[model samples]
Target: MMTNHICFIGGGNMAGSLISGLISNQYPTNKITVTDPDQQKLDQLKRQFSINTEIDNLKAVEASDVIVLAVKPQVLKVVCDNIKTATLKTKPLLISIAAGIRSTDIDRWLGGNNALVRCMPNTPALIQAGATGLFANTSTSDNQKNIADQILSSAGITLWVDNEAQLDAVTAVSGSGPAYFFLFLEAMQAAGKQLGLDESTAAKLAKQTALGAARMALEGDDDPTTLREKVTSKGGTTAAALASFENNNFNDIINQALTAARDRAIELADELGKD
Candidate 1:
């Protein structure tokens, strides 16, 4: 249970997901609060979760020990600036879910207070099946890091990186990874339909196959390459498919795509953090 009072700075989808996850896991509703400018959002969230709601950022920030900065990347600096004075007094552990904003920039925006954690969570978080990557500033205490981990782990699997730049790679791999898989699924479904199956059947086959393969990869002790080798007999159907993938340099294409995502992530930090 999250014993500490927690305040969310935004009442959007990501924030809603986290709150729902926490409530499902038996965290006290009374210990949580969410602040948003939108009255409709606050009403919906309050009705659904029964947590406290606030229109004033400073009042919300002052009342909580953990402040989740769940605002959009474009408005995160403004939110930080607005809460800087309150935070300087409260010293709440700030956890940011905004994309492409570095902890250093957040600290600087918050008047040099350094306790912050930057998190990247994918869309699957809504279903409590997310993969999140976190990077903490040097000023975060071990206990604070543990709290951050626990809070994020409520949503999905959590991974931590020592170097902040690794979060870029995390963004490329898991952050943008879901879309890559969806694209592959679309191609697979189309190919199945072309192979004389109906569209519904093709889609079911493609989606179930993807899900089963993922489960196998996660549950089995052996690595993915060995699992593939186990399934592929020489000159068999799987071998033919592998040959086609190799011929098209599928791995290189994936590398290029993820590299583009990581580069763009870094570029975004620069673009968003510029004076």
Candidate 2:
């Protein structure tokens, strides 16, 4: 329902997912444009979403009110440089979804003093079940912030952070959070198989259990701790398993893992933000 002429700089999976989400929400297809180097990808997107597709980034920027920089972090500067003139001329809100690249670096790449929103969206966004963390630079207006939220929320839940530094914590939590769940699922499947279930059965049960647990946590009124306690009775199998996890110092291990992820996120930002 937003009237903004939104343009995406990449036509990859994440971009495609966002386009699909927006269109499904009744966002006007005519107001959307996507630009990418791959003609085949662009053609597929155009056919699938019925939106405008362009190989020329500048032309796309010319008529856009908001530009989603969906390109990879390594080449974001080049993409920004290519469209800087048109972006300055149009003064569109810039939303960068490239990981590790800071807002200051993106602002600088676009010739500075531009409204920019930096987001860290995980791979789950490809399925529209994403959790995205967004941070807006001081140059961004309140209206622009709302627009950015609208666009990103189409994929899944979106949370705003007051400071850009908190995005590193976001990067550690939800950004890398999916992989942690996937890893846990993998372990659960392996343990199930070790307990005599066939591979297919083990995998299916583990996946379905994860899905059910997630739904309960999301939909139920109780918090996760309360739900966990409710399910874990004394002398029960769940309690035994939880005891094993506690004996293994599971909480400390997870804290250490997230800390490492957060530290790496900070390192990546430092590396990517260099001029």
Candidate 3:
């Protein structure tokens, strides 16, 4: 068991995922602590996984060997400032999951650019199928990074980037990618309903299609575009549907949306820097 204590400053869904992953990986439960303002969430965390819990972020930071910041972007600085004031110079490896908050800002708020890892993990992590993008400051050691990879990979796949700037593109892609998929699923369900299927039936069919298609893409030899082409025969139903989407510039629309999301992510990062 790793002797280094792990602490999360929030007990929301993302934090819950990390905590669960840590416990499932047999990292010492006694060495992990989660802090959140909500007593019910804390209780759930404690009851579900036999781990230590706290309500005070400052206290949690003081007691950690690896501090995971899993709070919202808006309140990140507030939390970081409080942690800085309460924590000793003997710093822990700070890993943040707050989207759009840069490591430099975290280091600044924490008083210096010490061991810090900036990460963006999507909502899928809750189900242990997430893909996370991680980047670290110069102060982060290889051993610390290995530890981070272990903790993160427990939930899903993890990719580390050399340039933190690429994280904005990652935010546009995977970080917010799940919602895009859910939107497509929702539209499919709605279309099914319009085609006279009942709500539950429509939902089930849509979900199955989404899941099966994803599984096929994963298991199939062909690439996604090739597979799509395979299903879309000339003058077939899929072809007709794709033709309509093409007429509406579907690919361009998606590009525009992602570009907007990426710009917004960068803007948010800049805003966080200001605060």
**Model 1 clashing residue pairs (backbone):** none
Candidate 2 lDDT by residue in tens digits, 41-138: 99999999999999999999999999999998999989988999998888899999999999999999888899999999888888888999999999
211, model 2: CA deviation in Å?
0.8
Judged by whole-model lDDT over C-alpha atoms, candidate 3 comes out at 0.88
lDDT of each: 0.93, 0.93, 0.88
Candidate 3 residue-wise lDDT at 73: 87
Error of 1 at 224 (Å): 0.5
The lDDT of model 2 is 0.93
- Give the per-residue lDDT of model 1 (tens digit) for 167-234: 99999999999999999999999999999999999999999999999999999998999999999999
Give model 1's TM-score versus the native structure: 0.98
Sort all candidates by TM-score, best to worst.
Answer: 1, 2, 3
User: Taking the tens digit of each residue's C-alpha lDDT, what string does model 3 give over 155-222?
Assistant: 88999999999999999999999999999999999999999999999999999988999889988898
Q: What's each prediction's TM-score?
A: 0.98, 0.98, 0.93
